[model samples]
Target chain A: MRGIRIGVCLLGLALALGAQDQANIVITGSRKYQMAVPDFNALPGVAPDVRATFDQVLWNDLYESAVVNLVGRSLYTAPAPQSEADLDSAGFRQAWSEPPLNVQRLVFGSMQVNNGGLVVDGYLYDVTQPPGGGRLLARRYADPATTAGARAIAHEFADDIIAALGFGPGIATSQIAFISNRTGHQEVWTMDYDGHNQRQRTNLHSIAYSPRISPDGTKLAFMSSVSGEPQIKLLSLLTNRLLPFPTYKGMAETPAWSPDGKKLAFAADMGGPNIEIYTINVNGTDLKRLTHSHGYDNFAPAWNPKPPPGSPGQIAFVSSRIGLPQIYIMNADGSDQQRLPLGGYAVSPSWSPNGLALAFAWVRTGGGEDSGASDIYLWYFGQQKYVQLTHNEERNDFPSWAPDGRHIVFESGAPYRTQLFTVAADGSVPEQLTSQGSNEMPNWSWH
Target chain B: MKQSTSRYFLTAVTAGSALLFSLGLAGCGHKAVPPPPVPAPAAKPTPAPTVTLSADPTSIESGSSSTLTWTSSNAVKVELNGAAVDLNGNQSVSPTQSTDYQVVATGADGQTANDSVRISVTQPPPPPPPPPAVQPAPSFAESVRDAFFDFDKSDIRPDAQQALDTDAAYLKSNPNVDVEVVGHCDARGSAEYNLALGHRRADAVKNYLVSQGVDASRITTESVGKEDPFCTETTSECYQQNRRGHFVRGQ
Candidate 1:
């Protein structure tokens, strides 16, 4: 029996890996999985608003995933199935699988209020299969019966559907940290990937910049002037308090987290004439200098999200060695330094979650001058070419890739009055994410 | 008595004959010589020549050039620095040292008027006083002036060099005083890149001070990027004013 159990586990792992491979193909190819999502049914005692909130959030999450093409509800000729009994009906199957709709998969769910909390039951059906064999996923989620709770339940359900469909992890639960002076002082602020639940994380009362979330989502490393000098400060997200960090002799700014969440790469002068890159442990130990060009300023280091096995990840940073700052890649230990071969002014590089491309702000016309406005560009390593992701935007900068690898969040607008915005990696569907007083420097969470 | 009278008569006759011969020769010449040309109005004195000379940039660096311009009226001839030139013109002059350019205007009546302009040339500062000996310590505001930078540049400009030289001299004399140089940028570039640029500015200042014989340990550097700008206007002059390396007394 033990051997059989082990064999079952191994089989499950193989199936998951196979699904992941198929999902990659779906993402890279021109075709997307055609699926239909009907509004989740409200069982007795479920508030109408709760059901509406869940349905809206779930639909948005799926659409933004960009891995599936959702069929419009206008094409539905019959009512949606809300339970196994309704799903097994021949009429429901015919409506979803018919030529006009031609949906390959269908997702439906039910919501109910129990013990003053919300409970959601979701299922995915492969309509191409026979009615008895169509069910592919079934899961239940529970939360407080509030609007936020309903949204949370919906997000969880959508993430589960995405995972089962073989798309890697979903970004519905990720957050973004940015700088906003809405409180009359520059402070660190965070929001959900969909620009919901904006909350201030730091009350430093002093200016703060570059809030980078840790890989484990437990800490936020940012540069602040709380002590009257700019220094890297680590804050415990779990504890909501500033942690102890060593005070270097010079200025420290623009801290980036290593993938393991164990180290941070930042730029500092250290009582010298040039700002070079350095790495330090999260606990302020094992300080290592990564770059040594004497008179050149090197900064804004971004670690590759995933490096080769048993190898230190590569770091993309801005260097002004050959005049205007340009993107340069070096090993985490500062070896194999090479420019990215892009001309004009390039700064603020952010590595894509897959580590195959870099998203950065580039002024293609002006060489480090204010005469030209900045736009976001992506340099794909494999293709050896660049894709312009923004155009004719006024000073769009600080491009941070979403964990899903399909979206990037950046700050845009005129100087001193900028706001945060998000755009798809393909340069479509630009969305404004912030409208308060002067927001800039958005860093997306790793998860 | 009769003989004397006869001699006087012969002399008078000789004078009369000479005068008649000269008059007959003039009449034979050109239609009676036009009655000896009427001597009528006296001429008005030629107006005194008026001249003005000036230089476009009255002062310049030794190797640089300045333009000398002169305008004169009612003058037949004009000379700049003893060389003939147009009455109303400008000439570029690169003098090796300080020079005074003079313009002389001469009227048709030969009356001359003179005007001059002085162009001051400043030589490059001597290789920063060779490691100045211990001197009296000047106040921070007097000695440590802010070093300005060009847009997105960290290389030391000549003016910046002069400010830093004075700062270096002060730092060398005051061995116990520690200073912090904070770099800044205009609100035009990405915040992250501006931070790096600010650091470059501060570093450049510190390096120049060190090269001038101030101990490196007496100085530190910081970069506030564009967060703490000195000026907030959107003009180029304001941006330039915001981009600087500000010096502060170390805590």
Candidate 2:
């Protein structure tokens, strides 16, 4: 489509303002990343520095999230040249081993001090359990002190791994948002989700975290520490300018925007022990309260947007009440609190836009090796059964429904990298999203 | 050892079955236990034992603890990945990485109960930032033209956003300047609808500038539905391009 721009019509803040106390605004940081997976276990036996470990963990987390599959290492070990005349063969094999494969493969690598501060060198391989083999993808490096040095090292290798395999790379192949401790404090950082293509979005050198993606993934809403208190700021991926959410009385952190793009709800300490849910217009006005438990702590209000049954407005939210935190359903006006049967405990509720059911993480009170492992489940109110999605011993939460509602994205980590995952509505076929730094708080937008 | 338990029960059941058959009963495999009789009516009663259950603190790292905590001391098995990790009294793991701690706390009677904590152990910090992404900017005129459209639609997409951001950057950098906004829509709809749609597109752009904190006095809007077409329409693209709000010179 030909580009269209809407001119600015500056109307002073709407006159019908809900007056409140003087806004003492406050804010935030991120352990962030994204990268392509040439090898799912590339960093496994590699050096264990903070960067390498971050790359590895980010990969594991993203893989476990089920957003994408980690094919193998970015670069694979190739047979060394027999002589100087074999350069052409070596290069050809390297290029051939870099893409997606008919036969799935994995590789591993490490980053360390070389020439200066750091350098990443790695390899990819072809392996599919029953039969295993190796092919060299590429040999890449990162100069010292570069933005996402480790991630960049990982990204190139991932790209090569993709090229060799014959298909596109996943999020490790795509970009991601996160928080990191560069410039001294935490700020929203970007790198290939697999830990490549790293850059800093918030140069406030202050602090920022809890990044929320816009419906189209062009903008990010995150909590910032630039003004001392955590303030929600909307940032443009294209422009790199920061738009702070209008100030509030206390702190405005952990923001979640609706699918329609008119409202943004955030966690604020309006006047309680824990954060409460508050919604505001994108222009930062018309603030409304969705919950008023008086004393009970409540945060994480996901806008369950199928528009309530029969009625025009209602939503499902997760709250801590009846002793333990559980899923509760209510009207948009904070009426009719019905507890959902999510077994022992359920938090981090993600509502599908089509509103067929709710997907949440709950503690599985059964035996096996997963005592601490959280299982993902779908609360099919229509079916009256809890369909379990993930059955592994990993920490999985923050389920974000894709615009299609067929796929649910979330964060998973065994400390690999805390990346994103996408699973079908029925809880089958999980794919990873990111592979590098920690990509957390993934809120998917409608296409 | 593996067969002993089953064989013992089988032998006992077989002997019992033989005795029952000899007594002229049909072949009997295993007999079910009878239900307990109703409790006797008594005022004086001993209280059921109070099981002092203590939560086992699984070895989770100091940071990255789940938002919840448990202190049960006499729990049965602690869950790590998912399956049970057998633990004695109070056991904990300092998982530097993300690990699930599923703690199965048992009551005084060996009937097991379960609780779990999903812990995410983050690794160390990463290196400095990567270079900024460098997407070639569309030419200045191409960008400005895309920012105009009907109301209530961000359907303008990326190309438009990019173009608007460019103009916005110029305006923001160049102070002491203002602009007039003119909105327009196609003639296919009623006058009111066209005007409304035009206003929405106009307002959308105007709001974008305002969010950038553009001066109110510097920017204003007027809508003209089929009122004026800067370009005669042949196709929808031309029609859409004409049905937009643009900024003229100002303060």
Candidate 3:
């Protein structure tokens, strides 16, 4: 790690922060601007404990994908999408369906307890009509390691969502990195999005938090108190060596990597009054400050929807500029501060892979670390509208959007331990994704 | 940064201990100080009676059951409970009905006794099967024993939240079992905390189960913590564990 910055002088800091101006370049494009509800029929998030509730986070994740649409199979009556009033007026005789079920694609699953573990059978269909209308597209099985499965199951659904959308099924088999306090010490953890095969990545005696996976899913950049200061460490998943942000000062908190996987953007005290945002190379060189909000703290960053061959370079982050926390979209550089006043004290702003939408935690009424009640919100760039995803009373925050952009992962301290979660972009499937530990600061990595 | 509080505490304790140790030596009667009348070397301490102890079962699973047994010669009393069991010897050999068993030992010289024998049972191993073929329909109970709040409250009361957790754990492990969690509440608070309680309780159960490996599809939660009364009987003691959540296996 080489090349660092000295934030000792404000004037000097101003000079260095100006260098980031070249990074903020935005582009206008229209492909798919809505959260895609991909079919998660095959995707399984830490499988639900219901021997049969039948609704899965995968379905919800797919719903968020806005790819494949979901019509609850268990809820599907033969003929109609009607209001409760409309349904009653139509009578039980009204074949339950006006909008065709499985019209775009059919995603169905069956769960059963087998030999002490949950055995799930999932199927995908390409339906043009109703009932037996679609041809079988693909199939998969999810046998929770035990009756209790986890985060990996969501990966299962994510896979099906992809397969259902005819994307040749990728990512259904990748891993996500998060933070968990399983060993009595908070450290970096990795588990399938469904919350399974949870393994600790860092075993230092100090508590580790805020794990953000690199674009290629080969590395993780997170904060660790191991060095006696909250410093940033880039960990190689393949190798066990730790790469601390070469000799930076103060605390480095939340972190995000560039789409190219060359640089890391993180928030740190950097010997200042407020925790601000900064970025550096993977080698810890060229330390660049992203913001200069003297007294206000700015953090929670996500690369703006970088797709493959054709991708726009943008960045979305949470900042408390107007006296209240909100989400802002900008160029990779620190310029063109466009605000999407989320209208609430928002934290953990996660940009979708496509950059069309953003997921965040917005505290509605009164509830913080003391009260435990908070909600998650989704901001759609296309609709220019914010949708509430979580209505539960538990405090939910730290959102991490899936590589696909339809799903968001976060952590909450409900009755259960403060752990990770994945919700549909619509916030419908507010499924808890961890067990037995205080898991927080989740960052999604690419497959 | 790694908050190695234990190490920090250890260092502090070590430094304090060193200072105290030195001060203790420094004050160790180095200067001539008159010694107080030493009690006539306490009457030749009577030889205490022999006490023998042995666990009825020496081992047990971390959470399983076990009993202890002990005998003391020339002792008047003894008792047993978990750890060293209890201190009194008045209780009976309540073996069949108790989970933790203990024994005490004592001596009757000026007269008292102490006794202890701790026996722990093993983790209920796939409960000695009904035979090898009938696999236990693995009961996964991912329930929340602590009551959680909604919006703005910080309290974890005990109640149905317990059973609700077991049900959740059970359901989480059995993905095939769809569960409809009906959240209930005792008559109390703004209808809000209760509903929120009910919903929170159910979500607590749902979240716990989901984390435990249960598929989300098999579980759904709702709250009625304050609205649904188990009995209009108007009693707080009876509504203790009932002031929370309930999980019903969904069809």
Interface DockQ of each model? 0.26, 0.00, 0.01
iRMS values in order, in angstroms? 2.3, 24.5, 14.7
- Residue B12 C-alpha lDDT in model 3: 41
**Predicted model with the maximum lDDT:** 1
For all candidates in order, the CA lDDT equals 0.82, 0.52, 0.54
Cα-based RMSD of candidate 2: 41.2
Chain A TM-score per candidate?
A: 0.92, 0.55, 0.65
- Cα shift from native, residue B48, model 2 (Å): 99
Kindly give the stretch of ten consecutive residues in candidate 1 chain A with the minimal lDDT sum: A1-10
Q: Which docking category, incorrect, acceptable, medium or high, applies to candidate 2? A: incorrect
How do the residues A123-150 of candidate 1 rate in per-residue lDDT, one tens digit apiece? Answer: 9989888768878899989999988999
Q: What is model 2's interface RMSD?
A: 24.5
lDDT of residue A414 for candidate 3? 44
Candidate 2 vs candidate 3: the lDDT winner is 3
Error of 3 at A170 (Å): 6.4
Candidate 1 vs candidate 2: the DockQ winner is 1
Tens digits of lDDT, candidate 1, B1-251: 22433453455456557767866886776574556664475574455666778787989889899998888877899999899999899999999799988888898899887778888899977776677587755677777888999988888999999999888878877788899999999887778778778877888898889899999888887778887788776668888888899999987
Best prediction by TM-score: 1
